[model samples]
Target: MSSARENNPPAKTGAARKARPLKTRTYGLFRWLHVYISMFSLLIVLFFSVTGITLNHPDWVFGNVETRQEYSGTLPEGWKTGNQVNWLKVVEHVRATHNVKGSVADDGYQSDEQQASVAFHGPGYAADVFIEMGTGKYTVNVDAQGAVAVMNDLHKGRDTSPLWKWVIDLSAGFLTLVSLTGLGLLIFLKKIRPAGLITAAAGGVLVLLLMRLAS
Candidate 1:
């Protein structure tokens, strides 16, 4: 029996067989997630990366270029007789006439003996309306920023809409998924596992050091 067992080839072990398939599945899943998620977040990553550099040095590219304009117009006659300060009518008229772009700020309206003022704020944009309560006359002053400034504002989520804020959140989630899946893929490669983990650890250390230095 001993001689027969020695002569015959060793039988394949059940555990080893199962382990191979499991490992393959894990590697496949990790690779699939890593590749697609990286691709999906590519544009989001690039946008944030470039914008990060631009944000760090605001004056480098756009040089704070802003266009200022003034416009004058007459309001509806009914607005004065019934209610001199019809907020909705005032905002709509200014937006339509001058093609204004912005959300009305909370402190947008103020009343005084002379005139009432309304302020609108948005990413790289601001528009203010001055109305004479006695007469239906109004003036609009708009300050529009350059492209670089607009991009920077978008990156910061400053004066952006709620929808855009949701987009930023989803982008952050996608990027996190991509990073975690990439790290997951390294676990299956036995040959380079140690080196890869060491490199990752070094990266973490480097970031910490940089932050320390910055502080």
Candidate 2:
């Protein structure tokens, strides 16, 4: 062993021996993943960001939207099949007749003593139709959601249908992994040790506090 040590000179030093190759590799992989995904999703990120800013400050600078929609539907065989009306058919008919270029927005169901209503808000406008399942009196309300409505409206796209939306959820999950790996890397690097821990802890506490407050 001594002869071998003398001949090879023990390549790894004390500091090198303590180093974590697995951690470094994981960090590097996650960093690359984060970069590529961020690049691919840059437009989406910017879209959300712009909408967020506009949503936050509505009064200062706001834009107007003009909505014109004509809808007519002959009742399908089971119009109220499965206790839910065929809202999609109505939306599709509107789109085909009106020549809407963008996606359809599906807000939650609106129900009251007189009518059960379904609402859809899309780019530049919105449409809500109350169809009496029993009597078949159709009423449509189409309007715009200024800036705040636009952000809220974006959440309603048919894009939520799990085909492309899966990419979004997947990216979000990987972003969490990327963040964790970055934290690990920061901890592994001794120079920036306490700062990383303090920032992470403070961020976590702030997020928890905000969630609690929101709830």
Candidate 3:
């Protein structure tokens, strides 16, 4: 019986070796994904993290210097034929003359009073134009809140273009993938898994406690 058991030990060891390859392959794939995704999202992660700090402490990031510019001009006479105001022409003319940077956010016309107002919005910048319909007189006010404010707005996706919003979405997805794969890799590390999970749990609990305390 002892001789038979010793011979069977080789068979058991071979089976274990076969199982090991599958586990190793899965771990390798996860590590690969974690490394590459983290690489791709590194800059995006840094930007959002830094901007998050700046956002939380706005006074530290930006000074109180806001720039305001005012311009008065006359719109094309043909814009108001009767009671109708050609808003497209007005927008185009204003954009061309003043070098406006953003898309038109609102165009409000008070037909009863023959008054038109248009607002343009972008990251940390706004422009408002008020026009008198029949007389073609218009006033433009542009407000710019500087570069730090622009970066903060970009982080929040405020007044940003659709393409930038897509970039934010993609960055978020990649970051999620990176985090999951990193956690998966930790599971394979026998010596470190317990400590890593405990640390993660502690960090999460700390955040929850902070939130609860604030509330």
C-alpha lDDT of residue 169 in model 3: 98
Q: Candidate 1 lDDT, tens digit per residue, 1-215? A: 99998999698888756455777888899999999988988998899888999999976855568899999998875554444477887778878888988898677788776788889889899888888877879898999988888889999999899998988998899889988998888887889999999999999999999999999
* Candidate 2 residue-wise lDDT, 124-212, digit = tens: 56566677766545666666545555554453343234554664565566556656757766776788889889988999999999999
Off by over 4 Å in 2: 1-24, 58-61, 64-96, 100-124, 128-141, 144-148, 155-164, 213-215
Candidate 3 TM-score, C-alpha based: 0.85
lDDT of 1 at 44: 85
Count of residue pairs whose backbone atoms collide, per candidate:
0, 0, 0
Q: lDDT per residue, candidate 3, 77-116, as tens digits?
A: 6776677778788888999999977876554334446677
* Residue 71 lDDT (model 1): 94
TM-score of every candidate: 0.83, 0.53, 0.85
Which is better, 2 or 3, measured by TM-score?
A: 3
Scored by CA lDDT, what does every candidate get? 0.86, 0.61, 0.85
